[model samples]
Target: MKIVTLDAGTLPVELIKPDYCESWVYRASTTEHELLSVLDNAEVVITNKVPLRRAVLEKLPSLRFICIAATGYDCVDIDYCRERGIAISNVPGYSTRSVSEGVIASLFALRRNFNEYVRAARTEWSDSDHFCLHKSPLKDVQDATLGIIGRGEIGGAVARLAKGLGMRVLFGERPGQSVTREGYTAFNETLRSCDVLTLHCPLTPETREIINRRTLSQMKPGAMIINTARGPLINEEDLADALISGRIGGAALDVLCKEPPAKNNKLISLPHSNLIITPHIAWASETGVNNLIKGINYNLAGYFGGKVKNSVI
Candidate 1:
């Protein structure tokens, strides 16, 4: 059986061994027009960040399975693939530990004003007056409320770490959905009450722009927001406005509407000490990448053996 990986560069180098499959073709780039020609005879296709829309899939008559390298399959046209009898599978829970660690880092960075403190520490400001530079105030995380949206493996891991730090944890309920968990609260209520809010949910139709102007208005005046999930999950412009107006204390995002946006994006220009944006590196840890590779291999083996695992559609 032929197995073609459109963007194998995203996976770890060690994971792409010849022993994993019978026949393999790897390419770093697969343009829309070139995709059909590349995978015409393949039985299985693997992709990390490439899109597999109905237009591209319709041309590949022999394609039987799709192995998405990530947990979210928004890039694929699931309904169309289902109609074509193509099986789709995705990797899940691979980045739980990596993303949980990133959330903790962003939380502490904002709470303690670490960036400002570090800058002051490196300068000669300490020689002028006090023992320690008091440019920005530090806040303690102990006894603070941590609101978690999406109670999946990543969110659960984050909650566990927060509880260990003596934080009160409150899981947010889905909109129009009742609070079923013991300590769960209404989504907006949790947003208003928590000192720090973190998002780990997938970007579905309902979850798109979950943190926007209206929701930002409901948050505590000095609440901090952390998002390592999909970019569209939070409206970028609205978030920048909230930070500028002090509606929310600060925000740390690892994803953006555009990956490596152009030079003049508003979020990049929002010159507040409170706003921090990393270039979507929350899930790029070495350990997490290795785990993702294992998931891909497992799914590939299952597909070739005529059994399906991790099917999203």
Candidate 2:
């Protein structure tokens, strides 16, 4: 069996070559122009973010299985794969602990004004007459209401961690549904009540741009937004406007609409200390990376052995 891994550089950990493989090739990254030639005659392929749409997949007659290196498989065209009998597998829940921890850390950082104070320590602390140079008000995390959008593994993990810190966690209902599920708070109510709102939902047609001008208006003034989920979950331009007008307190985003976002991205140029944007590293903890590697190997071996694990097809 011929195996190829596209964008292997995205996974920092070492991947063990399967003993049952004849040809195993690894590429640091694959460009759109090079996709056809690179994947030609490959029986199996592992990809992180390189897209495998229907148009691209139609040309690859030799492609049999796709091992998505991450939990979110939005990079691939699922319907086409299903139609063509191509197997797809993704590693899920591997980053539950790492990503949930990142949310808690961001919550504390934003609510407590860590960034502003850190800047003060460097620039204004020495010159102040008082021992403590007070600037932004620091809010306590305990007894604060936390609204979680998705109740998936990572969202549940975040809720557990928040409750342990004495926070009130509300699981938001589906956006358009009027009937509130037994364990869920109404979507609008969650937005109106939460002190901090974090998104863990998948990006679908219903959820794309869920946090826009209308939803932002419902949030409590000075409420913080944290997104470790897909970037399109929030409208970037609207968020930038809200932050500028002080309608919302702050936002910490691990993923953006564009990864390695354009130099001229609106949020990238915001001069607010409250907004925190990271390069999608919320799921890159050492332990998470190791678990991902194990999951990938398990899926690969399982498929060829006739029992598929983590099968998406």
Candidate 3:
């Protein structure tokens, strides 16, 4: 078997190789322009972030399998893979605990006013007449309603954890979906009712920028937004504007529309004290990373042995 990993650096740790395999791993990222040449002779290709769309896949006839190194397979063209008889697999639920905990952490950080007080505690406390400086309002998670979009494993896990914290959880139904389905609140109702709105939905034409100016206007003026989901789910410019205008209280994003965003991404340049942006690491707990690696190997082995796991198409 021949295996070629377009971007091995994505794993950031030692990885296991399949037994008796011809393998090549690239430390640097391979662009769409460079993908076909690098994957020319490979029977199996492994990728984390580099996209393999219809145009790229059409040229690679040797590609019998695609092993996605991460949970999301949006980077690949699912229909093209199916048409080409290429087996595709992703490592799902591997980062469920890691991401759910990260979302909870972001929730507390914003709601408890930790971001404001952390910077204030350095200077304001020294000049304070009292024991503690009142930099901002501190809200308790116990009474706050957490509205979650996307009811996947991560969302369900977050709901369970938030309920344990005494939070009122509302799972948002699909947008424009009128009939309230079982175990779901209407879409606009979730937007209108939440104290903290978090997105766990995938990115698609319908879902991209679901949080635009109009939707943000529907949310509570003080509601905080946390996106550990796909980035483009929120309109970056509109999110910055909402923070500036006090339409929303705060936001912490683990992903952006563009990774290592252009020097001019609206959210990246904002000076809002309530906004926090972490490199896309919500799903990158050390344990989660190892589990993903194991899952990738398992999927690869399974496909060759007569069954494939975690197929999106």
Candidate 4:
């Protein structure tokens, strides 16, 4: 079977070996026109971020399967693929640990004022004062409430870490369901009470813009927010306003509405001390990348052997 991986450079080098499949071809980049020729007779196509809409998929009649390198399949046209009998699979849980670790790091940075303190120490500002100056104050995590929006694998992992840090954990209670866990509380109550709020939920219609001006106003004063999930989950403009107006203490985001943001994005010009923005690298850890590659190989072998794993369509 012929297999073509567009944007193979996104995958770890060790994960895409010739021996992984019987016949394979890889390209670091594939343009819109180039994709038609590259996938002319391909049976399987692997992609990380390339959009596979109905218009693009209609040209690939020979394509039988799609292996999405990431868990989210928003880039693919699932309904179109299903109509054409093309199977779609995605890698999941591979980046749980990596994302959870990023949440912890961002939380610590915001709560402890690590960045401001390090800047002060490096700029000789700390040395100028006879006594150590607390330019940016730090908060103790112990006894503080940590509200988790999603209680799935990554959120649960973050909860464990919060517990280890001596912070009380509270998960959002599902509607029409009992709060079985001691740490779980009503979603709104948790939102109002949490000292730190971390989001690990997917971006669905109900969850889109979950953090808006209204919700930000409901949060405890000086509360910190961290998001390692999809960018649209929180309204970017509202978040910027909250930071500027001090509705909430601060925010650290690993994902943004636009990957690099437009040149005129207001968030880019906001004060750096109250906000931390990363270029969506929370799930790009070496270990996570390797696991994702392994998952792709497993799914491919299963498909070729008449068994399938991780099929989303």
Give per-residue lDDT, candidate 1, residue 307: 92
lDDT score for candidate 4 against the true structure: 0.84
lDDT, residue 227, candidate 2: 99
**Ten-residue region with minimum lDDT total, candidate 4:** 11-20
Query: Per-residue lDDT of 130-232 in model 4, one digit per residue for the tens?
Result: 6676776788887888999988889999999989999989898753366777767987788889999999887777888888888888898889999998889
lDDT of 2 by residue, 182-246 (tens): 88999999999999999999999999999999999999999999999999999999999999999
Given candidate 2, what's the lDDT at residue 86? 92
**Error at 172, model 3, angstroms:** 0.6
Name the regions of candidate 1 deviating beyond 4 angstroms.
Answer: 12-14, 20-23, 124-127, 180-182
Model 4: residue 40 alpha-carbon error in angstroms: 2.4
Clash count, one per candidate? 0, 0, 0, 0
Model 3: colliding residue pairs: none
Model 3, residue 133: displacement in angstroms?
A: 0.9
- Backbone clashes in model 2: 0
- In candidate 3, what residue range of length 10 has the lowest lDDT sum? 20-29
lDDT comparing candidate 3 with the true structure: 0.89
Reference-based TM-score, model 3: 0.97
lDDT by residue (149-253, candidate 3, tens digit) is: 999999999999999999999999989988457999999999999999999998889999999999999998899999998988988888899999998999999
lDDT of 1 by residue, 1-313 (tens): 7888888766557456446567788887677778878888898888987889988888889899999999889989999999999999999999988999999999999999877777767775758577666766788998999999999899999999999999999999987688777767999889889999999888899999998899999899999999998888889889888888888888888988887687899998877887889987788788888889889889988886789999997
TM-score of each: 0.93, 0.98, 0.97, 0.90
Evaluation by TM-score, superior candidate among 1 and 3: 3
Better of 2 and 4 by lDDT: 2
Which candidate, 1 or 3, has the higher lDDT? 3
lDDT values of the candidates? 0.87, 0.93, 0.89, 0.84
